[model samples]
Target: MTGDFRYRLERGGVKYACPACRQQRRFVRYVDTLTGEQVADEVGRCDREDSCGYHLRPSEYFRQTGTKPPTAAARRKEPMPEPEPSSIDAETAGRSLTGYGHNNFALWLCSVFGEEIAFRLVDAYHVGTSRHWPGASIFWQQDVTGKIRGGKIMLYDAVTGRRVKEPFNHVTWVHKALKIELYHLRQCLFGEHLLAADPVKPVAVVESEKTAIVAAGFMPEYIWTATAGKGNLKVVKLGLLRGREVTLFPDLGAFEKWKAAVDQMPGVRVSDVLERRASEEDRVAGLDLADFILREQAINV
Candidate 1:
């Protein structure tokens, strides 16, 4: 009953090659989102109630391990505030698009990919520049329905194309900066608008907006998107991908966490390419999909 513990459908009920029955698509696992850990190795349950009755709950695992379960108070659900009308109108997002020269991220992107490719990305993702900090950029989150959910403003090192997290973490939200009182912010996936644009294309989800943009540039086959954070992969946000093929590319050290989380959601697959290919040093450094792509691009160049 812990707020951090919630049950969700595994792989949207996609049948996988079951270990017990050797059948497909009948496994679900309990995950602790707080710590990004799977509760137990054998906690996955098969849906075949009779034939493959492989079920293991977190409670049972805790009992077997002699560990105390979360208290009822910790499990009590807190009321979520209802989303009010967003004050972040389209005009606000549009304004940031005016000056790319000031956008450090875009400038860096232009250097790596050239102006033509970089500008295309700028237009495709609606990348913008913010005066909040010189060379700061804004990643606008627009939903499939064409609604501007919110904008994440961040500062980046123009030379490296990496976020400038030092000096007090240069990141902020549009609604908060504007001081729009009672603005109920309902965030959607970054680059979610692409889902409506191409329904047939499979989805490739990543952890950062920067990664999504870079991946889409290199591989245009899949409709790339970003959850914007490791812990932001909420079940509600994934509802859009219910009927589509979705693949998750978590950063190094995140494969197991993402695999466990996506196991309950059908049609979602977590890639092990990084896990298999990355060295121990790469894993420790937390290299992501973008790093690999960049490294390969450099090699070719």
Candidate 2:
């Protein structure tokens, strides 16, 4: 019997009330592949972005219920194959650092934080420009051990510093773009390489690479890093933070999602700054830490 491991919307085409808001047709439930059953009634997401944002992953459900989901070995009749470790050599990582003239994000950073600080941030994070699209920047995910795992390429508006998602949702990975076959890509936290630079500084994590850079510029006290996305905050990727003080500054709509995920993680704390201070308008706009910092900077100026 061949089976695949994935999650799909429960009862396709049927409307289900959201667990959080009770809104109909927005809820999507996770279905267990092995048992051919819904894992949990509330283990899914609500599509409503503004009013109701509820997403409970299978992993979160398992953690909450104190139950272990079926392992790969158990799920498949055949023996599970081990995945190979993927790596980007130092040379490739070095080559990416060469072109900063067309790096719009870097140029924008230079304007906001000034040349010295912006150059430092770029060098520290291995921020690169891609000829793939003019003004496209690469946020390389270098591991704590100084290995280049991969890079996430994204296009941003130079003046606004906002990501350009329309006309294609401009995002791609270095590994995929290079067509590195058999490369088992495993992404670590963005800016993770900074951990090796300062063993004493407490780590502050956000959801976007832009936020990390901006936050780091304003508050040099804490080492700022990003998960790259809310869902990418996995326990495995956080292993390097074992004994270190770690704080999560999730985006406005992501506080609960991150809080629940890190409950069992020792030495990890979630910041409630945005949750406590944000107005309904800010929440609706999906404001993040970077937005907060910029607002304060503008006020002080």
The lDDT per prediction is 0.78, 0.82
Candidate 2 segments exceeding 4 Å error: 1-82, 235-238, 298-301
Q: Write the per-residue lDDT of candidate 2 for residues 47-165, one digit (tens) a residue.
A: 89777778888777888899877776766765667675588888886788967778889988988989999999999889988877888999999888888888899998888888999
Error at 229, model 1, angstroms: 0.8
Ten-residue region with minimum lDDT total, candidate 1? 1-10
Q: Model 1 — TM-score against the truth?
A: 0.70
* Residue 96, candidate 2: alpha-carbon lDDT: 81
TM-score against truth, every candidate: 0.70, 0.71
